[model samples]
Target chain A: MSFQPVKFYQTGTFTVGNRLLPPEERSVQAQTKRFNSINSGHRACQGCGEALGARYAVDAAMEAANGQLICANATGCLEVFSTPYPETSWQVPWIHSLFGNTAAVATGIAAALKVKQLKGERRDIRVVAQGGDGGTTDIGFGCLSGMFERNDDVLYICYDNGGYMNTGIQRSSATPPAARTATTLAVGDEPGNLFGQGKFVPAIAMAHEIPYVATATVADLRDLEAKVRRAMAIRGARYLHILVPCPLGWGTASHETIRIARLAKETGIFPVFEAEHGELKSVLAIRRPLPVEDYLKPQKRYAHLFAPKARLEVIARLQQLADRNIRRYGLLEGN
Target chain B: MLKQIEGSRAVAEAVALCRPEVICAYPISPQTHIVEALGEFVKDGTLAPCEFINVESEFAAMSVAIGSSAAGARTYTATASQGLLFMAEAVYNASGLGLPIVMTVANRAIGAPINIWNDHSDALSQRDSGWLQIFAETNQEALDLHIQAFRLAEELSLPIMVCMDGFILTHAYERVDMPTQAQVDAYLPKYEPRQVLDPAEPVSIGAMVGPEAFMEVRYLAHAKQMEALKLIPGYAAEFREVFGRDSGGLTHTYKADDAETMVVAMGSLLGTIKDVIDEMRAAGHKIGVLGITLFRPFPIAQVREALHGAQRVVVLEKSLAVGLGGILATNVRMALSALPIDVYTVVAGIGGRPITMRSLHALFREAERDDIDPVTFLDLNHDVVDKQLARERSTRRSGPAAEAILRDIGVVAAKVAQEVR
Candidate 1:
């Protein structure tokens, strides 16, 4: 297929499509265009991170697979917002799996595609499963692990935005320590999220020693796309965890979604790295390290810590955790 | 075709014959064997052209299935109890998106007390989830229902669940007349997904609907389910014509003609009830039984037409609602709301408790005498509860104040410190 130029409106109104430009220049969802993978009109809140992650991840996968990709999405903010009824934002072959079973569902899709391949009809089809942190970590952990163990030909993606944003920002296992979510209230001394709880599934995936496993941040589109491309190259089970910060759930400024995600990596709160078969292969080095407080203080979800005398000691502990992560991952080399 | 097979294996054969492109699931007890069988098929190549996904939970299982189906691939999965609860959100999504993914529910009891056995409660809880729900009475039916389920689901663009009694139908070995590949192919044609992922045309599957069309969109799904009420029987008839066995589509009745009393039930217990009815019939009792095959549509019209002639209709369901009898009883009451039949409700075999022929016979005798209560807990041991309560009270007086005692252990202090800020 020939490349189409993305259409831009001469008026700075942020409308993506216009009549004058060539159809190739039009946006993916433009009326004149046909390759709109993420269809028009979804229930996603304004500037939803999960939606952005989905659009980018799915479209990139579609392009990489030569437009022969099927997406199995977990039930979360993405599924609810995208397909409300007779409408959807997905332009490719998309499915809405349950919150916990995206990985499994994608595995099934890949299997089905393989069956077609055996029949001598080469469709060049690939499968991808996407979900929010809540669905990926807590509810669907077993299925995810099973996919890893079986090495099913699927690339499962988790858009980690800290909590269960769809169901009223409840605390999920991916929720950072001391973050205020609906279930983990901002009351009591520790205030907002429990300490030393929650599992880091990326590390667990490394233990399984699958073909590929990586972590990306929405802040770095190039890195995210690169990781997705690398994941697509592999045949066995693969996982890509993307740090897509939820503005509504995290109680942060909508535009700061990318900035907060960038800060998260710089602060060593959420590391960006890749591994293969139970071994740490590489870490996306941080040029300058920032204190974890910079990443935490801006979001109202973590605002509880700033108040009640700013909890300097707690901040110190969090900083210590970040420092430990840096040293453990060798996140920075030389001064 | 006539070989000894585990109930789970029988289900796998049926699922394979349906030729689902995607199989997504998390294995929960009683249902694990079915998934295990499917897993082996993926490995051995008995089931080809399928992606067997080992999902993290039932939630993911349903979610992945929805995505695959939306992408225009036939999908299937199985779960029970906790697994079903975990995937509840995806269940609603699959139906809302109109994906037509088929899920096999190995009916098991939910937990608090942590029991694993045959019960309709798990499947019953999701009755309103918009998936076409069918309850299987035997292992053969479990296998056959799965085949019919895929056909019905795809035809209506709706997800479906083939519910069967846990270990009873899932673990038992049975001689099922499996359909040959040619026969199956002829009966169930290849699935060409209605709304599939096509980059050439690029259309979205699940999109966000605004307030303007949200209600209407849901109404469309509701209408499809209502449409299945008619569509199911038509397809079932076609299946019978090809397969040579009548499934009765929604509800199956036995010896209801010229009978004054009828026992209504669902799931594997129907087999035992039928056996007991045979004995009762030979003994010269004017009694019969009606086994409910479909739960979601409730088969309200068929149920009413069948029960209208009977004087006393006994409803046996495996799920309870505290004071309002069983779920099926409530549905039957609503169906027969306009009629004058005396409906007796019995909540039996909950938490996988076995409903034996003796127990069923005794219950039927009670139903015949008009001595049966409107709501009866079939196999509850209340004495155990009374004994446990007495023991707990005796020990409580000797126990120290809750907080003071917890503090003395030093653990409470540590917890307090963590929260103290």
Candidate 2:
């Protein structure tokens, strides 16, 4: 619900959310009164998408929950950066357990709340489990699946940077094919990551058939914020997997993080869509989508393909993969 | 109500009395019955207003407990052997964050050979993991200790592991004086967590502390466990007042006042040790049995006071440090290092091996004459071991030693490599 239709003066100037919009219409991020859940003065990298995503998601959750949200964070870039011993960046009640137990911890929090609420206590306290790609799609998969299957009252948000970015940018099952990570080096015939290795976990979440599942990216902060708010609005097992770009890990310019993520959604590689009870609700339509090479060419992780050998064949295969996702999800409107 | 029941079922009943808000568990042998009974209780509405989560793994089990405990709910779970190790990281996380979650560790052997029977190796392996560790000597203690465990954990804001002998106490049918919920409620107060995950009074938990605060953070954890030493006996005193029974404490000594030699042990094995000590004392032997109910806090002061005039102390533990000697013996030696007593360690009941009364008789006789080795494996088949040692010395590529020994004894098939085993 944009204020663009009603107010013509603040059109491009009030790009997303601003003072021009009504208080109810403005996002939590738009208002200066928003609780900075993951506050400033943390050691997040320059233009870190996870940092941005966490801020947007947690603030939106806090707003939707009416300031009754606690977080369980997995050990990754977010946990490590936000808390470094004597100082902490977390403004809300937060917990950082082991690398992969965040989902279960969040489930436990929900259980505690349920037990307390059943006894006629306040029932508004909600729980969120947040993790990077490694913690979600790989190590924490079983717990996440269990949480979804149990329909635990939790909103699990996975900030997918496509690899084990926290552990020095290694290959995770979430790492896309033909992506160069430390473990999946660009030194082989099928250079970077081998095709058919990585997993698409949002579909896996849908297979469990929980309440809500959606995908958003850091490029569209408004969309990410909206999905988080919507997920928080639901009662049971909601998953919102946001594709966050890691500037350092992806070998892209710090400012290119949003641009890269935008390209990822536009190219139909990481399908921006929502599903409720395993049925597709809608897709964030891909507008004027370019080829996969247009998305891949910016990062140094894919510099090998551009120089000495313009591996058009590899780019073509990647395009085919994106095309497949587009066809499967009907990502282009009216398709 | 006193009734004969399986130790696991008894423990389940005792836990039910504590009125936990969240109970999560994964199925591991010997531990299965406890959770299964609790599951039935939840289903039947006997344990009402509780969340019984059948978690996927031991890791998730502890993780769930951590969350509930942090959210100020009395939480619980159970595991044995590999399951304990599987949740080892979360185990540390629970205590590190000082969540008052009580867990039952059905003591089972950790394995490469994968033994499922009773042993203290699993519980003892987590000694340094920052949880308060206690052992049970009988089904009654197993039942009573769990009730106290919840209070002790909540009071201290630390996780507690109540280790009971698996299959021995867990599977064995024994009479237990199970406390009523009224008694438990009157004794144990509502869980008021020292720190909780509440939106009204929000505080960051499980923060990533770096070097500056990491050591201090660990020191505080250590300090809390040390505080358990005083609170354990204090709780036991209050428990005796409430229930009219002598159950939990730092240590329990039987006929140890005027004894010259004393046997020190933990868990259900202490019952067997006490029985032999009783027979020996009746026959004019100056020996006694000291059962350690609280092991992780290691009861240094009480241990010293218990063995004050004793000339000799025998430390019998079921778990070994592998390459090093007895696990309990190491701690006992350190606890008694200030004294002039001679401490002997006899590693026993490994992989559920039966430590018979006959072996205890011979060992005590040898201990009486001062003929026992400094470190002895009780009733070990020395012939098979010596042969295996020689076979290993005579060759470079000696096969799997356990299988080799089994083959020699005709237990393993001749072509053991091809056998299913």
Docking class of 1: acceptable
TM-score of chain B of each: 0.91, 0.95
- Across B102-195, the per-residue lDDT of candidate 2 in tens digits comes to 9999999998888898889999989999889989999999989999999999988889999999999999999888888789999999988898
The per-residue C-alpha lDDT of model 2 at residue B353 equals: 78
Candidate 2: which stretches are off by over 4 Å? A1-23, A188-190, B393-398, B410-421
Error of 2 at B25 (Å): 1.0
* Global Cα RMSD, each model: 9.2, 3.4
Off by over 4 Å in 1: A1-60, A72-91, A120-122, A131-143, A157-201, A216-221, A241-272, A278-319, B4-6, B24-38, B54-56, B171-175, B282-284, B351-362, B378-421
Taking the tens digit of each residue's C-alpha lDDT, what string does model 1 give over B226-277?
7878987887888888888876388888998888998899988888888999
What is the Cα-based lDDT of residue A31 in candidate 2?
80
